[model samples]
Target: MAGKKEDEQQKQLEFEQDEVLTVLARSGDASAFNELVRRHRLKAFTWASRISKDPHLSEDIVQEALIRAFLNLNSLAHNHRFLGWFKSIVRNQALMKMRRGGLYRRELPATALQTASMHQASVQVDDINSIMDYLIARSSQAENDGTSKDPQVLLERREWYGIIRAFLRVLTPREKSIFESFFFQECSPQEIAQLFQISVGNVYKIISRSRQKVQEERLSFLIRAQIRQRREDGLLKQNVLDPVSLKESGGSLLTGTEQLYRFVKARHPQLSLSYVDGMLLGAFLLNIEKSSVDMSSTNMIDRNYLITNGMLNLGMRVRYVEAFDFEPPDPNLTTEGIALAQGSVDLGMPAMVWELIHSEFGLIYGYDDMKQQFYGLDTQSDEMVPYEQLGRLQTRSLFVLGFVGDHPISPSDSLWRWCQMISRHARGQDQTFSGFVNGLAAYDTWMDVIRQRAIEPLGHAYTINVLRQSRKHAMICLAELVSEWGEVKSESEINQTIFNLLNKAEEQYAIVHDRYVELALLFPVPSGGEPNEPANAARAIELIKHIKYAEQLGIEWIEQIAERLEEHASRAHVPAIVENPPRAYIM
Candidate 1:
């Protein structure tokens, strides 16, 4: 009886390992997926070598196959059949590589090449309706009754659709309308907003919420299915619950500054430092500053802009995944958020997590399952906080960053996009808050508050620090741009003039930043000190005048640069639409 019990336990253990790993992997648990890869890599490699016959080529085939498998892991109908599905991918990739090589060889002869080209040209194309009908037929067969007769197969076919439909049924009427309008009608967010009598951003919010609901429902379904399967297989006895824990061994794949440094190094190893700085400039990661009466105490100007736009401006194709908004953070979203973070790190990409502590952004590089901790870079230092602790702090933002394989846009085009972003931002056109100003007008608004002696010492100090840091980084980025594009002798004179204006503005902003720094030191952020005297208020008003003058000068230069670029475009016979600066706040 004892020996039989041991045998039963062994079977249960094996079942648990397979089912749990697959389920977790499907749910984007990186560690579980890594384990699955480790167990299957040797077999996959062996299969590829047998098909390719060339060891070097087989290695490439296997790697590509694995990457494709991981990318399309969700498409796998049956978790138990993963090995077979993966093997098929390997075989197909290897066969396609061999066929391409063979085709190239066959094309060597002029007669063969001519005959092949003629044959390709003569191939008939199917009409859209015919192609659609064929696809529907194929999909219906697969869903209703494919070759498989297994119970799991039937469960997947019948229950998966049913689960999705059930979730759709749970949506409110408004949500359903938005969903249908966006997905079925293929309407733009702006169009949907008009139809619904809402803002475009609201349309996005509704869609995002709907997607989150569907994702949560799917996860619940998968977990339930796995539990049922385990019971049916007799691997789990009645009333027995499988132990679910997220713990794995291994240090971070990339740590500290290495995450940012390595990404740049991978692309331009020879000039790694320059590339790293460029990324920093592009990402606005280097523009660390403080702000008050803005959204937060300290603000990174780049934070207001999309990192995707910034990277694109730097000539990188980036897919932006806005996990969730940070306002009104919810603890219930932690599981999905953690999975997203881990998945990004598993891909050798650091996820930017917001509100790590003190409303700051951090790069999450690693997690410790046993400790239930996440390792990240905070503003002050590298931090390792309990997962639960971090979750409770209400971090609702995440970014998965990766480089594109190739630059698809020209440098000139990228520069134009960057200019547009800058112009829009500088004009307060993108401000999200009422009564709060942004761009050049923000300086005037801030001055008005200071002139009224209504700003708190702490708030003034914070704003000063933020402005100082923003200007410093702006100077760095502008100087880098000059070094990059100004050396082109063929650049139009007007374009050259714009670059000179940018440099001048950078210098002017630096002086303004320095003045703010001096003021901040005079009226530093209060740390439980006596209240500021009335005499200091008079001094503050005088300082505001100097700041206002410097800011106006900077804005003038920026406006001039914009006009110069527009003039150059006009002369070059290119249509240019330059927007006048938006009106500033009444001060």
Candidate 2:
């Protein structure tokens, strides 16, 4: 009893402190506002960092947000709600930075906060206050009525487990499995899709239907309880009880922002084309097609590396940011993700998100702060994910865009770098996997795996798909290079020889690509089926051997081309190598 009394006193003291700070800050006490900033700086920085993925920029955004909060302090109706209001400001600032391509005036007049009026800030504050009031009232009513038991909370209490078990009975077996996997086990839709041999779209549909069923039953129970209460109270007239709308109970807070990409383009004149074209251009500059596979995982490769390489290859700077090195139990992770995505959208650049619901690369293009929803496209589908939903994923990776400085390597120098990379790949140098070989040698290792049936059928199929896609892109790159360099009249002989070798290599890769496509169809990744009979498996092995032969031939041709280019470099007027080449952060 004594300890409980002490706890209450402590809480009261903290409340008083908060009230005092709030009042002082609102009355233009600069020191009080600075104190508030000091208290919330780390959290605000964390939120901004998650969104912008750039610590330097995140710091700028947080400072701007605090200044804005100070200027608009009068707009806040309640001092207790200061943190939430300030968080919203930080989110908005991050979004604005993203839309402006990270361009913001760092210096503000010292008196700017004091001089600014609260008129502009009142509108947003009023909106936030209204929503908060409604939610608070609803929560209070639920507590008073003894109907505040959340489904998850009930499940946690072993005595109340029966309640959840009974509610789950409404779902069919398949629906139950999907619901459990999605909500309980926390498996991503893509992982579930792979396990069940279904599409990601179907996974979502199933989860939705199950949730709707549960909600309908819940509504039915509530209606029956209300009717019984009215009957017991001797209220004969039906009008005595207000009608309840079923739609209200099942409605979601998730919503999408309108015209975000359009707004981005309008604001930034340099981005004349669609994001798709920009992504492709980045890919080409980085030579991503050449480094899309890891010999060990087969289907898995380091996407962060690819993005970084692409940006660097284009002479553009980049910053890699992550929410955490390892997963944390903090609830604020989702808020951070939403803010980060919103910031990227505001910048007019897409946030390249990793470990999405589909276990694939997702581009977050828009966000609705009011509804707390992020709109993005994955390899499987375009969808709107709730802000809270982002926290459930395993990994949260972000790629923050930076401006392109002067060309790090000239066109000719870039070509030379490409030659070196290709040679390294051909020789299987700098392999990421220790046990498994890489590049040309990876073909032999893969062939061995196929012959032994060591890899799963679905895994093999996915690998083949990656190979086919990468090879097709490689062919495009080769063709583009040939066309680009072919016009140079000075290096005609050498260029023709290089072009001929490239064409041959393209043909070789094309054949291998077509074979992989055929093999992938036989395995059928979406089916999640077992490999074919022994004869068919043997046939695949033979095809792998053929692929190996073709790849070896391509390697020989590349080596010869490298030799020819070197010889030409000796005779031709090659530009002297710069002593200090431009440097940019790679990852």
Candidate 3:
């Protein structure tokens, strides 16, 4: 009687303390709020358990409810009503959790708490109904006919037993023993709990967790078995890539090329996306054709040649296949190209595809031979293309590129090749499209189009966005070079000079990056802002001009770095050998 009286006194003190704490918590006292949680967390869990009836689910509900309450404390009407408001939140959370599980359609009955205690027992009782019915029917038939049991019937029984064994194998040894004793041997949970020397709740939890684990594994095992049987019967030929996600780009052919490059780069730890972009000249490329800023100008160069050259520079042996290259599609070429694409996907390498969906490059990462379909993703989204219509989707052209192997190349050789490519691309020395003005000339054309208000708003905006992102990467690449050079223990004065040049180059690109960013704001994508307006167009022109001058300065410093690399090569004079030379198949 005294203990009960002491409990009442303690409860009175707690309620008074909570009233003061709630007022402090409302005023943004974090420690006061923490004290309130400490006092009420156990009571919250109990309330949630009463409402949810599942202890595991109740735990989650309590946690989420507390977070919601904390986030919404300011909405409480009265400080002294904190407990009531928190209880309401906990109840709402429990209901939401039940609704998501599809278990709360109507109001729960008053006897739900009593019935929930028997739920585990009911499930265990239902497990034997199917097995017992099957056995009883088979025994009755055998006795009445006095004939040998059907072979198929025995096989079915064996299959059921095999499944049981498989499920047991998925459990730990202790779990297997406990589960067998409780379910197969018909031992009560209390007896098992005592035998295992564990609490009754622990026994229930272990059984629940083990059952869920077995059920999940059983489904996966059955699925794989079904697939295997279908394959053996020649009913299916399907291959789906797992755990693959495309590294999206700003909608350029380099998007597809970079995806392919990433797969090949997995074999070389020395390569990174920034490094690849630097080597591919993707970050530095600017091509404006016919004094117009159009869509095609972003990728007007020889795509196949550039991709092949870039991969080779990285020492990756590339396999290139195409059915149409500025020519009519041939059936023979399509067949060869499709076969190679499927083979590359089968080898777990994403194949770069041209016109896979729209009139642009994409990737074919998976296929289904029986369904005659290929799974790919493009700028639009993931798509399933019919196998026979591989090259006839849009442009009636097929182009695919993948890496077969790699050769050895020193970092110095790779850097030198990259610098040479950068210089060539910046100088427009390797421009394949005639009307297109590349490099510094391209920037002038961009400004001319803006000044005349002849810019294609969408294309201009896209160019601004892509180049802005690319130049940001260019800045990162230059900074990476500075760090790499700083790490070299060379005493050569040329090394320090080159490092200084790289820093200067990085600074120029940083300015160029900022200019592009300013332009992007003036002509935000899809909407293109108000670039068609004279004021915005004039501002865009000025930004482009600034970008051009800074880019030119960056290129000058890059050329100086290349000169220093040449000097270093001369000093070594080791007769730099190129073995196998990064082979490519252009067919």
Residue 283, model 3: Cα distance from true site in angstroms: 0.6
Question: Is candidate 1 or 3 superior in lDDT?
Answer: 3
Give stretches of model 2 more than 4 Å off. Answer: 1-296, 323-326, 329-347, 355-358, 366-375, 379-409, 489-492, 521-532, 560-587
In terms of lDDT, model 2 sits at 0.51
Candidate 3 weakest lDDT stretch, 10 residues: 578-587
Of 2 and 3, which scores higher on TM-score?
3
What TM-scores do the predictions have? 0.45, 0.43, 0.52
Local accuracy by lDDT, each model: 0.51, 0.51, 0.66
Model 3, range 269-309, lDDT digits (tens) per residue?
46556666766667788888554575776656556656666
The 10-residue segment of model 2 with minimum total lDDT is 249-258
Model 2 per-residue lDDT tens digits across residues 1-587: 99657545443433456567889878877656766775667668766664565667888898899889988999998998888798889987876676466632432211112212321221122122212222333344446867557653233333222344455678999888887676545488999999889999999999888865664444334434444554577643211111111011111110110122222232333432223122222111111112122222532233344344434333444343344323321233333344445544544455555554465445565565434456655545667765555534664332223222323545454455455445555575532422345566666666555554555656556656555555555555666666666676346787788778777866776676677677767766665345546776777778777876876776677677767777767524433322222111111
Error of 3 at 368 (Å): 6.2
- Cα error, residue 37 of model 1, in Å, equals 50
Displacement of residue 6 (Cα, Å) in model 2 is 63
Candidate whose TM-score is highest? 3
What count of clashes does model 1 give? 1
